[model samples]
Target: MELIQKVLDQPVAVSQPASLRPYNSKLKVHDQILCGKIMHSNFSKLAYSIMQSVGYVHDIRAVLFEYMLL
Candidate 1:
């Protein structure tokens, strides 16, 4: 009861909601899935690039393949 009273006593601040008119929401399920897969692959690529930058001789493709196998 005290918590509820405290919450009610606090002043409420309202912010304008974001407008999403510029975004596309009609994407297919397969497209969304493919986008997710690409995003994951990009993360691996980024890791591979970081590894190469740090002088690791490991093959990125091999590492990515092993990741897929799991």
Candidate 2:
């Protein structure tokens, strides 16, 4: 009963809300690599479609270069 009373008398520790925490803007190495891969995949698909519609085909590297220029 005494131990229980002591515990009860102690104050509870409250954690701050998530919104109060600072945001981490940095991405991990693996996360950065994955994002790059996803972006490259999307750009490749878009370039391929555009080339097909134009009745011409070019190297994937050239298409990617054009996209980077824009």
Candidate 3:
């Protein structure tokens, strides 16, 4: 939880366009779409884990109610 909180609290990091390009390669844009998808999957798992840890609310109905309250 502390690590996740620390990550959330930190300022977003940006990379220079030049640095984002692959070494000696010719892709115009960085693969940000793929990166975003991967991050989304990992974050979803972390959030589910946290939710499970906080309470014995593993049912879909309870999860939805809790999420709605938030």
- Point out the higher-scoring one by TM-score: 1 or 2: 1
lDDT of 3 by residue, 6-43 (tens): 54444332234536544332221212211233234454
Encode model 1's per-residue lDDT on 1-70: one tens digit a residue.
Answer: 6644543444322122114223223222212222344344444444444444455523443444445559
lDDT of each: 0.37, 0.38, 0.39
TM-score on alpha carbons, each prediction: 0.29, 0.27, 0.28
Which sections of candidate 3 miss by over 4 Å? 18-20, 23-70
Q: Best by TM-score, which number?
A: 1
lDDT of 3 at 40: 45
Residues 1-70, model 2: lDDT tens digits:
6644543444332133324534232222212222344344543444444443454532333444545559
Which residue pairs overlap in candidate 3's backbone? none
Who is ahead in lDDT, 2 or 3?
3
Candidate 2 segments exceeding 4 Å error? 1-40, 58-70
